[model samples]
Target: MSWGTLRNSGQERELFKRRSFVAIIAIILLTGVLVGRFYYLQIIEHETYATISDRNRLQVQPVPPTRGLIHDRNGVLLAENRPVFSLTVIPEQVSDMDALIEEIRGIVQVRPEDVESFQRRLGERRRPFEPVPLRYHLSESEMARLAVNRHSLPGVETEARLVRYYPYGRLTAHVLGYVGRINEQDASRIDQVAYAGTHYIGKTGLERVYEEELHGEVGYQNVETNARGRVMRVLEREDPTPGRDLTLSLDIRLQQVAHEALGDRRGAIVAINPETGGLLAQVSTPGFDTNKFVTGIDHENYSELRDSLDKPLFNRATRGQYPPGSTIKPMMALAGLASDTVTQSDVVHDPGYYKLPNSSQVFRNWKRGGHGDTTLYDAIVLSSDTYFYKMAYEMGGAEMADYLEHFGFGSVTSLDVSDERAGILPGPQWKRRVHGEPWYPGDSVNMGIGQGYFLSTPMQLAATTSVIANRGARRPPRHLRYIDGDIPARHLLPDVVRPPVEMGEKSDWEYVINAMEDVVHGSNGTARGISPGLNYRMAGKTGTSQVFSLEGEEYDEDEVAERMRDHALFVAFAPADDPEIVVSVLVENGGSGSATAAPVARQVMDAWINGFPEVLTNQAIPGAMENNGPSGRDPQ
Candidate 1:
């Protein structure tokens, strides 16, 4: 017993010692590995890990400051920041997201758009602790309801935000385009680092042109948050630098006046300060509500706006292309006089029609009986197509194209807003290049009268008129006056210089200006209707552009559809002696300038002349004359 028991005890003690040795070695190896890993992390990646940890612990969320305000030439606010309340959610603090959404839905109507937007953001894999906005611009009732039910809903909150508002709504929609949500397309175009927390971006018009000035630099706030993502105390904050204010060349009163003058017409009116080329009023009729595009327009509303018959979304002032019709007669007349093709006194006997050199197809006059024995002055005043046809025969298309191109025909005006069409300046080269056809005399005849392939935007027409008013000094048409306190006095850019628009002699311009004045004021003038009550002498040309080609048969206004009727057009500069403003108006399917467009232009000119007092408030008339009142009616 003593021998076996003693051996067993010794073996048991040996086995125990072996196990302890192995255990000690294992512990030592594990401890060495842990120490090496800790050293690697602490020494090599210390800065990165420290930064990441700090960021996670004290996340500095962006607090977007108020954007810059926009005012007219007068200090009346056009665009401003309005206080808006929104609902938000913190996913990390929420246990049941579906239930929370449902709960919010019961309290305040949560739209599919809200759910879809949140889901899209979640898919971006943003941090769960950060709060994401769900609904914006919440009503007071909705906010109160959410606040009342906050005890039952965790991780849900309401926040106050500054939203963009257009006080005039559809009145200034085209000129002051609305801001929209940042999308994939915008992200690709924008610098992600620069726009760290920006949600809305300018999509078009002045908003897009002055984005840098309008979007303020982002600011950060450091607030201590609890384990459940509730803010405990504010540590520090970097106050945001608010965006700088902008003052546009636009006259809000005039803009409102012009908008009303259009009166449901589908067209564009561009008015510019001929002295400085500052755009005073840019009105596009059938304009959509800019507020809808801002924040976010719903699918149905967006579709309706997009698919409407009137095409309210289209910016006709800058983007629309139309044949200038007789409105181009003044430019043609100037071209003829400047080119020495025709003299002011040179007489052309127009017997209702003008036959090109060899061709028998006669280009007929609007007045089928024709303006007999018409000179350049008489031709311009009457808008004689027959006289221009003969001039086209003498000058040819290439020479005429060269002359017209000087007045911004078939060219962009380099406007502040994007998307300007250089209307068709069809020459021998352009016709050959694009249409794969040779230039002909008939083409020249059509181009001479602003027909055939020649097309121009209302902005271009206004710009061209400004050149005439300024006596060949072509100023750049500018919409934005200043950006971030920097004044844009003249837009005559250094890199781009339009070859001096020389009309051969100053007298040539004078003759054309005289004829244009006659067209507005003369007894036989087509636009005489506008002159009956005008206090200031305005020089203008009336035009009627046929939407549909007249196939030899005379147009019966009664038989034709309203859409198929001729578009009335007028280009004018006020106070002929010292012209300040140049305006171009196009009334879609309005038939004649004298009947439809001239009246609208008259209202615009009246506003500009009278210094745009509050609309319809005629308390006292300072310079009210008896014979010349607004639209020939006595000033009320």
Candidate 2:
């Protein structure tokens, strides 16, 4: 057996050849598979993979369009946009958000509220890759410091953006309103794609009303960026469409004059162009600086405004409701004439007070010894409350309400004005619904003189006067005169159109207007004190509304608290024959309308008529020589 195994070399060689053949075949198959895979990746799918890689290096960014500018009728800037520096952060680019925020605190003063707000926005649903603002309105020094140390920060950036600014400060705060940083409530309602890079939105007044027109179209750009998300260069861009510029009906000069005249008083004044229905000047005193609200007002500053007794944040011109007092008499007189309840020649014997035919509850007149044997003309000129009491009693509440509604009472007057209150013009139905009582004769008497639940806003009062100036033609008040240099017709606001107030006889309008003229120019007119220089003919009525019920007690101005006293009011139109401006003034806690409120009306009227005379001239009265007295008469 040992001799046979020694000669087995040939069998061993054949086994080695079979193993080599298997190894060679495996190598050839693997080489073919590797070549096919390389071709598939390098040639067939090149475009798709190339696109994926380019997306990592390049980004599509949104560019916010510039906001529109706002100007007054005289082309004075009310609201404008100014460049400001702000700190922003992109969360996706940040590796450690807490560490980056801490580092930013060293370069810039970041408030806790700011950081909290930033965190809140970070959690909100926003466009992908958009930067969130951490701090706004940065100082130049802070920006410089951040620029020098920016190399160490990855996601932090200092960007210059346009911010809203009001040049008039508090003068136009109520009318122009303000812009504030976008919040959760605003973000939810806004178009996210359009506002991708925008951070602010209008909060109130005209700004809020015209937000869509003011916010321009958003644009986009393709930009190359580094690993840290820093933009290296812009490749392609689509320019944005700018917002439409606005021209308001307000006059800044007149606004300045009205604000200065009201000085330190809590009141409202509204002046409108009777012909065009455009607001000439709208002012609410004790207004706060609107700029504070634009950049997120601090808690302390906001509390001061919100808690102040004067309510600086309130828009009194459009929202404040006050008793019209005698200011309602002119409209009431027109209402009486329109309904034929009382004629221009009808007489009422005002004997210090009025009483219902069956009830003994006497409604006393403002004048203790009342205007005796007062005609409609004499009653208006002298502001005889007793005469109006009788007229209102004769007309009844329903007829009176229907007549006044035609002048836009108890309803919103302007379609364009935001947040205007529809004041209460109480009638039988309104009284029954609100007080759960039937309309009593005494209620009519009290309402006749603009009291007993009667309320009207300064805007409404001005609109009423405008109707009288137009001789029963109704034109709703409007602030927007034109948009983007396009002046459509004279009265552009067609939506605010109201039916014309018709009188049985057209001459009735002239008769009532003449009586109103006598109220300022007549020898016994209640507002005669304001008719000094005869530069122009004006018609006006004075009014006083008691804050508290007198209950048969005489009003002693010195005894009552200033805040508890009567409110002074006046309504007027200048150049009586061809009226251009109609104005209404309301002074809170002012004792006498003729004394306290009329002078302010005179001053404002003079401002509009004579361009706010630098120095009031001393001219002789029109009939002072015959009267043999001073140019000006004492207020009644």
Candidate 3:
């Protein structure tokens, strides 16, 4: 071959080799790029894809803790938790909720109220997937019937929850209060995260005051779910902490006795341990069933309670304010003795009426013939209004008002219940501000006898009686006893002391106490009717507050309508020498403090001193009723 031909052939072979090398390099680079992309997607971004996959399958749910129980001082269960089966529906899960509910109705008894409640909750602003309650507190028969057909019903579920119970029923209704369904108003104020799965909350009394401690914490769980949001298994969970337990100061036995003693009378009874200031019983007649509020009460039932003349919803013990009448005589006499304005032996002539130094209006005594001449002790024991009227005038309005305020009059007691009324304490400034009128001498006379514009609550009377029993060691009354369990610590009680009214030298506190005892034990004593079978002595003062007047006429119970009669009041501390309990009883339009109020007080004291009969027998509390015996009739 020629030299040129050899060179061309070698160049062609080299060119072909260079093209093969370049192609091989391109193939290797493309393989490397593909491998890198696959590695990034499968290994580096694995969690991102997994999370996206889970988004289509997992469910989260809340678990509510059981509410704690409540007991009285004597270890009797007062408030308890009862298991309840409820039916619910998740709107998002139901293909047609209305149709499903209608279908379920044919199998079970469903009321309009149930339908209305379900619809109302359905309309609320909430997540569509969350379950809404349909029926609560299901009956055993109903649960059994529903169970048989549960498999056929789609999106319908049965859940077991604890329902609050007041075992004492209406007896302790006002004090323990009741729980109700969480409404929009309550939802607005509650912590959404903490109360995520809860439905009920305390509405009033101790229940409302201790809601945080009573309601346990909520817990959450994350679960692996299917495409339909059905739970397969829990991936993680946080356990819920239970609510705290409470020990109350109430004595269930004493509460029952007080409730029974009141009968049908429209008034209140407050009994307390004099030493510790613990409330033994607080009875407010006409209290409604606390169970009605739990699990949501119907409109008709609720309306009946709200519109009833007896005011079943009203709490008369802590809320009723009334003119104290002759119940103030003993306290006033004590004030006179402590202030050195009057001595124990000090005598005042009674001419049946009191004339405020320069006034024409005569304040007459209840007895038309007047109590001849009465000493401070006799005046208190007899509850002679004329004597107090004179003493009040002599002491001046400002002094009397100041001293009475020291006794806890015209002030809210420390019962821990919210909405306590601070009654009127008539003074020159108060009169000017409230009634826009100047103080009058006649006002002082009336105030001294626990009438006129002076007003006080039954709780206030109990507090004052406690002070008297303790001989001036005033501890504000309390309705609850603190017990640490799963509950948050209760709010600390504020330091309180009744003003230091000197009880030493000139104070005739002893004389007044002695006289009060005599009223129940001595001859011709006003309250002797109820004292026949007493084991211990009790010092008390009786009172009659006029509900109506005739400007210049005496009251005749026979002619007056039953509703317009005078209110009977009595306040006492038992075992006078070493007082253990202080009691205050008031009967509306019952006439005669001795005949009406004293006997009720006697029954209460007996229950506290001996044994509570009804409690021992495990008898159910009778309805609010009154004794119609001759003793309870309008007095002659």
Give me the candidate number with maximum TM-score: 2
Residue pairs of candidate 3 with colliding backbone atoms: 244-487, 263-625, 263-626, 264-625, 264-626
TM-score on alpha carbons, each prediction? 0.87, 0.90, 0.87
**Worst-scoring 10-residue span by lDDT in model 2:** 627-636
Candidate 3 Cα misplacement greater than 4 A, ranges: 1-46, 125-128, 139-154, 485-491, 494-499, 503-507, 614-636
What are the Cα lDDT values of the candidates?
A: 0.81, 0.84, 0.81
lDDT of 2 by residue, 1-636 (tens): 698878788888998898898889889889889988888887998888889878988888888889998887645678899998989998988889999999999888999988887887898876677788899989989988998998998888889999999988698999988899888789888888888778789899989988888889999999998877789999999988887788888877678778888899999999988887888889998999999888778777889999998899988889999888888887888788878898878999999999889887888888898988989888888889999999999999888888888888899987678889999999999999999999988888888989988898999999988888988788888888778756642454663455555755778778778888888899999888888885889988889988998665788999998899999898999889988789899888978888988888888888777654333221211111121122111110
Q: lDDT score of model 3?
A: 0.81
**lDDT by residue for model 3 over 1-636, one digit each (tens)?**
778765777788999999999999999999999999989988999899878887767667787877877877645677888988988787887898879999889877779998997898887766447778888877888888888997778777777888998888788889988888787888889998888888789999888887888898999888887756667899989988888888777777678778889998788999988777778889999788898888888889999989998788888788888888888887888888777778877898887888776567788888887888999888877777788888888888888888888788888877587767887879888899888999888888888898889888888888887877777778888876666532322355543566447754423567778898998998867898888879889998888888877778778899999889999899999889888789999888888889999999999898776655643435443331232231111110
Per-residue CA lDDT of model 1 for 306-376, tens digit only, reads: 89989999999989898899898888887887788988889999888888766678788888889899898
Clashes of 3: 5
Model 1 — TM-score against the truth? 0.87
Q: Best by lDDT, which number?
A: 2
Error of 1 at 136 (Å): 2.1
Candidate 2, residue 379: lDDT: 88
How many clashes does the backbone of model 2 have? Answer: 0
